[model samples]
Target: MIVGVVSDTHDDQEAVAKAARLLLEQGAELVLHLGDIVAPFTLRRFSREGVKRLIAVYGNNCGERLGLLRTAESLGYEIHDWPHVVELAGRRIVMVHGKGPAGETRELVEALARSGRYDAVLYGHTHEVDVRRVGSTLVLNPGEACGCLTGRRTAAILDTETMEARVLEL
Candidate 1:
């Protein structure tokens, strides 16, 4: 399975579209948005070609939470809260928005991955791309799809069979 990872959209529809396109071109079957999505309408941009599943979590700036859920529901999708966990391809994966006091979120995410309780920990908030290994766990942050701050649009594609994460700059 090829999973697409995106974060910190910040309501930039254009960037989201580009990122989604890149993910699709790379053969992403599942797409995960780590938050900072901003508006419900932004979710529409991700409903593009060749995406099997679109999963998302709320970020610190998730305004109109209920509306977001409604939008997703209307589109036949679901948006979860932080620390969402699931087993995919026989591996436990933890998904989080990573919104909180500075280093605290990073520490918690790192701890969760280091505890060996998950095969991969996917998070976003800092708008900086990061990929690391903690024990047997893989920690990945796909950076900011909106590229509001860093000006570099990015995402990641994770190969479930090989546990490899490839960062994509759009």
Candidate 2:
């Protein structure tokens, strides 16, 4: 399965729509967002624009900007409060906002890797697109949809079967 990964949207409706549209056009079957959408409608917009099977986790800014659990539930989106884990297409995916200690976070992810529990760990908060393999697991951060401050908007596409990731500039 090919899944589109994105993060730190920060309310750029246009960019979000464009990214969703493009990914859909590219034949992405699912969309996974790491953090910082800043509004519930962003996900709705992506769904409206053509993305199916949307999954997301919250950012530090999500409390006030995004919908509550019930709202997200109604929208057919699984909104992870924080530190969530899900399995898809035979690959285990763990997602967090990555706001705490990088060393500890990496250690925890590495531990998970040791268990062969996941295929990837996705995070957002640094606004940097990164993909690396930690032993058998892939650690990824799609980073900053509109470049909030850095002007570097990007997204990632992961092929679950191949465990390959492709980064795209929006």
Estimate the TM-score of every prediction. 0.95, 0.88
lDDT (Cα, tens digit) per residue for candidate 2, span 1-170: 98888988877998898789777876788888887777777777787887767888888777654364555677777788767887888888888776665565556656765677778888777787778888888888876887776788888888989988888888
- lDDT (C-alpha, whole model) for all candidates: 0.87, 0.78
The sequence of per-residue lDDT tens digits that candidate 1 reaches over residues 86-118 is 778998888998766748878988889879989
Instruction: List candidate 1 stretches off by more than 4 Å.
Output: 48-52
Q: How far is 164's C-alpha from truth in model 1 (Å)?
A: 0.6
RMSD to native for every prediction?
A: 1.2, 2.2
